[model samples]
Target: MADKSLSVYKYMCKYVVGTENHIKTIRLMNTFTDNLSSNNIKVTITSGSFGEGLQMVGSDLDIMLVDTTIDVHDEIKSIVFNPTQTNFALMTEDIKAGFAMLRFISSPNPAIRKICEKFKGSNYLSNALFKKSFLSELCPVLHGPCISDKSGHLDFAHCLHSKYWVTSASQWTMRSNNSWPNESTKQMIIKYGVLFVPIGSKGSNNEDLEWRMSFSVGEKFLIYTFSHTQLLVMHS
Candidate 1:
């Protein structure tokens, strides 16, 4: 990746900046639009740019459909997400259902029954990651106002923290030879932080060596964290 291309690519991918998956997502979104319209549902992206990030290799596509008629209330509640039972045959139904579904998915105070019905029943990382992106940015990129108008920025932070913990925890568990679920390379994200700081040590120590060896090959975790941190800090 050339320096100029790298800069362009960073902007290209809002979160998981990459080229391959972004194209794949665009195709998928087009397909979804065709299918939804064929079924009389009008769909459009509200926040995210399709084909702008790393695509999940073998994950389902999670999309939010909004109806054009439903009145988007100001008070955003997180207890109405329902995909299994919520029929999305038309645009109108999808908007209402999608909003409710999102609220349910991201609600700190979620409805157990609804959550279990939708999220718990599914285990697809692609759609889950897509949802995470949309919710993180609060922009739908599908239709209507972004998710930000309803919820605060906490959703984005929580999403990042969750991804980081899942990835880092997996790596830590694997090195310790512990089989506590999702060993090293799960669908979750990986983030690297300085786990060991020497106490006036001259240079790298055993701990540093071990950490470097474990993460030297792929520093995406470190890269993403630092990059995003810098951007956010500067903006703030």
Candidate 2:
């Protein structure tokens, strides 16, 4: 049997985070797409821009570039993946042909890996939010096949609602509470990365800061914490 409270929470998320942030995310996606085109990337941008906030603060503008040929490594470094973890750079002519069809990988499933919903329809409102501790709002997709994988792009965009972001929020809660054992949790705290936090609308002037989490690729685990909430992810 499912817990009734969870349904309430899902409904709340759909209304507060989904309905509200979705609009702002769409606008941001359009602007980001235009910016990519101007850069001559011949790419498509999808929106992974929703969270507890309605795109007001701490929301990620995750996009994908496809349909053109470019160096996968260069594109990964310049746009898709966060490079603060390493200083590796791509070669100039690395952006050559025959690498047009590739898919962006978003990991850490929210439903099982992090949030465990005991209720039928109700789930943690933060279950599917993206961690943007080190992510900048603007991601430039430099090149690939934006045509064939259009649906895949959109699917990837919405997947954040069920995966990476939620895991991020949970990890954030775990770190703040010191729930993880020993010094391991300390190392996972994002000191030099950008993080995503959810905010609520306070009319048109203020926004309520809600759930958020931080992550780094080298930490080997995710850490996050909040009042009465704690979560952690360990690499095996």
Candidate 3:
């Protein structure tokens, strides 16, 4: 039994588990995909299980389309006026954790102004309306925060990029840990900031105005730091 277990582990490490070269190839493929898919307004990011170089069967290709034209900031003062991009302030007060309301600050883009609505004397972006606008003849199904094709092979999450990190995750940065995720990795995670998916907390009153915070970029970074043995263990 012990010999069989050892053989299985060795096989997994040699074949099933992805090596650093495999990860590099996956990253290169992702970069190529991104280059082909990305445009002036939005940047494409490959995500999910495959993004981590774990090629599991029957897994959908997860993609995040980050709107470069839109900018989200945690605080009003942190926002810098850009003549070309739409700006939104992330409002977290009284809202559920991992979710926030995007207050429409200013936008030179006419299309953005058309989707925004006034609520309680404040301009706010409607998550529903924003998502609705993305629906078309080809991709009509709304699967959670992602827009999926009829075949369900692909999931595209339309999201906004924020330059500033959220205040809610501040504790994570200060958390003491002897091993795993060094200070440099933490800084890199913070530097990338976060993405806002076009979804809200279920049963929340501000569902239409709220966007869920996504730490996928940082999560991917952490996954890349995993060793071959760690990957094999995770796969098992």
The best candidate in terms of TM-score: 3
Alpha-carbon runs more than 4 Å astray in model 2:
1-15, 18-32, 35-40, 50-57, 70-236
List the RMSD of every prediction in angstroms: 20.6, 20.6, 2.1
Candidate 1 local distance difference test against the native: 0.28
Q: Which 10 consecutive positions of candidate 3 have the poorest summed lDDT?
A: 11-20
- Which of candidates 1 and 3 is the stronger one according to TM-score? 3
lDDT of 3 by residue, 39-108 (tens): 9998999999888876666789999999999999886774567878898988888999999888888888
Find the 10 residues in a row with the least total lDDT in model 1.
154-163
Q: Which pairs clash inside model 3?
A: none
- Which candidate number maximizes lDDT? 3
Q: Write one digit per residue (lDDT tens) for candidate 2, span 1-236.
A: 37786675455445433433454465565666547564443344343433111332443344433222221222342355433221111122221221111122222332322322222242322211222221233422211111122222222121111112222233554545445534654544432232222322223211221222223221322321211122101110
lDDT of 1 by residue, 3-41 (tens): 987665565445343344444566566557646553332
Please give the RMSD of candidate 2 to the true structure. 20.6
**C-alpha displacement of 195 in model 3, angstroms?**
0.4
